[model samples]
Target: MKLKKLVLTGAAGRLGSYLREPLSKLCDELVSTDINDVGNLYEGETFIKADLANFDDMMGVIEGAEMVVHMGAIVDEAPFEELLGPNFVGSYNVWEAAHKHGVRRVIYGSSIHAVGMYPKNEFINTEVAHRPDTFYGLAKCFTEDLGRMYWEKRGLESVHMRILSAAQVNNPRALGSWLSYDDLIQLVTRCIDTPVTGFAVIYGVSNNDRAPVDNAKAAFLGYRPKDNAEDFAADVLAEADVLDPHDPGHMCHGGPFASVELGNSGLAGMNVIDDRKKS
Candidate 1:
């Protein structure tokens, strides 16, 4: 695996804070980007503040990097107007800039919401068609298609990760959705190191017993997550009454996001305890 330079967007968010250090090790230089200000930069990283919605800013943030881990975005169910700028336009800007900059790969931080309308019991695979549950999800779909187009027409490699949940499992549903921080790192690292990944849409879920997607297709990437949510099940299950098993949040792909309103709770509802950089 070539240790090429990496550019990481959303450097200040929950997942990015966890990913900042380990991901920094994968590259000769890691340009950590976010709209917010951060302190105590990592060893191999340089911080850059930029709006994802701005094409010029996005392009400038990604300049000179060989690959990008696009984790920047509004992370919840927002109104279409709210989503258009950061979620939709930002995604396009990132891909377009990556193409123009001669960058080789883009590892997208796609959400499970991209296929959120699918039934919960269906045990979806990578082969399933997108059934987005929210406007936020629709944007993810757009990027996946953009990735396919870029790969088909321009030879740009894209690895779209349908991240289920990149934090601690807080409820009964998350047993299936949970993706530990270490696992998230492992998944992204695999996406980065794997040679010749021509526009693949893989799940960023864990090795949980109740995992919905069959990620065997992307198994060659060598992302074998070591963590499991079963340990939290005994306790969390005791608190959460088993749902109707028919409601979309309980029985469909979006989980809580299926019922959430525009700009309502999503990751904001998770019991994610995000810690900052260690001094």
Candidate 2:
């Protein structure tokens, strides 16, 4: 199925920047929205400065779009109060707007933190129950439920892509949970073009040798990730210090996020440099 008009939230985000060009190749028109003004625009793309929390503005902007790619939210792990408005309410506005506007499918950016409380050694599939590690993870859990409810009750086809990690290989943990930008684009493309989809929850992990999750559901979505993080293994491994398994950073649901003091730089502590921008 050809997706004609597409609405992409979080258009100014790290991953969204990478998706701008590739998404345009598939759709006749790409309506990219974000709270910030994304200066440079691409061919066949329209950048609209809009917030995901504002229901009226969001619905107005997404009126004519046939599909919605919901990506706008506070990315870092934060206090519950900080996550309520943007991550929680914002997700609700997106789905309600899509349903009200008669959009067919919603491609969501789910996270590993939704099930972060599970032990790293225990291999998780999409079927596992949610055990949110932080406020950020709790928000992800909420949206996944929202997506499922909307699909089962309202007849909206939804795909929750449980992205394990979408960043550069920084340390030892990332080697086992990396989701490269190219592979991400491939995953989103398949989610959009798949002929028939109900409520599908699939892992966004790449073909990593040390991957924590088993993506046995690959046949369901036909997502064949060609990249791996083994090339960075030696360097990342050597750079990372051996940690105490009992430490919350190692033991808690969100690793660093679960260990870091609230309101601290949880993302910064992870040492992720999201340099997905162009020169």
TM-score to native of every candidate shown: 0.95, 0.95
Q: Locate the minimum summed-lDDT window of 10 residues in model 1.
A: 270-279
| Predicted structure 1, TM vs. truth | 0.95
lDDT, candidate 2, 193-273, per-residue tens: 888788888888888998888788756778999889998999987888888898776755466876776656568778778
lDDT of each prediction vs. the true structure? 0.86, 0.84
Candidate 1 residue pairs in clash (backbone atoms < 3 Å)? 77-263, 78-263
Candidate 1 ranges beyond 4 A from true positions: 2-4, 267-279
Clashing pairs in 2: none
Tens digits of per-residue lDDT, candidate 1, 1-279, equal: 556678999888878888889988888899988999667888888899999999999889888889999999988887789989988899889989999999999999998999998888787888789898888888899999999999999999999999987766778778988888889989999998888899899888888988887878779888898888888988988888658776677777788777677567665645666654452
Model 2: lDDT equals: 0.84
